[model samples]
Target: MMAGLEERLDKMELAIRKQTFRENSGRANEVNFWVFDYDPKKELEVRERIEYMKKKNEKGTEGFQLIVFDLYDMIMEYLEEKDFVNSYGRFEKRRGFDYIIRAVSTSMKMNEDDSILIRKIVEQTPENAVVFLTGVGKCYPLLRSHKILNNLHQSVLKASVVLFFPGTYTEQELILFNEIKDDNYYRAFKLVK
Candidate 1:
């Protein structure tokens, strides 16, 4: 049992290293990452998602890291990514970003635990990188009401967010949360389909 666990751990480390090496290989000192769909079946789903990205991006001839994390693992992964970028001479100007598309599926008001962790990560990232959050239903109200989020610059939002409100949103809601959708820094709601 211990040996099996050890092998799995080694595999995980290798996967992360492979991603890091690929993304930084030819991007002119830039870091490109994709935070894809998350699922509870982490090991299998994540690996499959990475493989899918690998195939999809094959024509680009450039390396990029594609990450997927379960809600339980999101916080730690964010911190790990934080440290990883900092170590590579990008302590503040980190180039990586994350996506949270499970917000609606996981909680009616957004997961406070995840929200706090994401807030910390965004607070720590540099001003240039973008973070995106997306999911079905309106997470805008909750996000806007959070006192900790108001002060966070759009440039440093824990992640560039694309709240999946699903239905047409009111102008008032847009006005209240438009900064969250500022496209000057990064693209929001990049249509995958």
Candidate 2:
């Protein structure tokens, strides 16, 4: 599985460089979005592959730049900077899930509008870059993959965005971590098996 995934990623990188990678055609056969899905269970393996790719990039593999946005690390950094850990440490009575939601919400300032976090992600991304989005499993109830992808703007997504989902991605529906079934989203394409 790991070797196969690496081969797929290599092909994906080639496609991205070509800038002709389309998920599917629109109503008039127009090119659709450039969102690719990968198996979530291979998160660690994917991370290693990305690290290797980054090294290759450093060694002068050019054309498209790879930028990785690890959600778990980003959220943890935010919580620590905001001093939420100390507060949580003092109030050890709260349930783990509740504490997590509170911490994530407080750190991300999640409101009725959940797109804020996604927008922040887009803002952090560089122009004309291939992005690798990871750490979805760690953010479970706090952040849903479908929610972020659904809310993501095409304009903001200058290049292909590969979401390393830690779950099953069927034709249209996204089963997050194999527990939650998100709504069917059509804009993105599933990486071929």
lDDT tens readout by residue for model 2, 74-173: 7777768878877766655555667767666665755424444666677876655667777878877777676556656333455567777777777578
State residue 36's C-alpha deviation in candidate 1, in Å. Answer: 17
RMSD of 1: 16.7
The CA lDDT of each predicted structure is 0.33, 0.65
Per-residue CA lDDT of model 1 for 143-167, tens digit only, reads: 3322222333332332332222222
Clashing pairs in 1: 122-158, 131-159, 131-160, 132-159, 132-160, 133-160, 133-161, 133-162
Off by over 4 Å in 2: 1-3, 22-41, 89-92, 111-116, 184-186
Q: Against the hidden true structure, what lDDT does model 1 obtain?
A: 0.33
Report the C-alpha displacement of residue 39, candidate 1, in angstroms: 23
For candidate 2, give the lDDT of residue 142.
Answer: 74
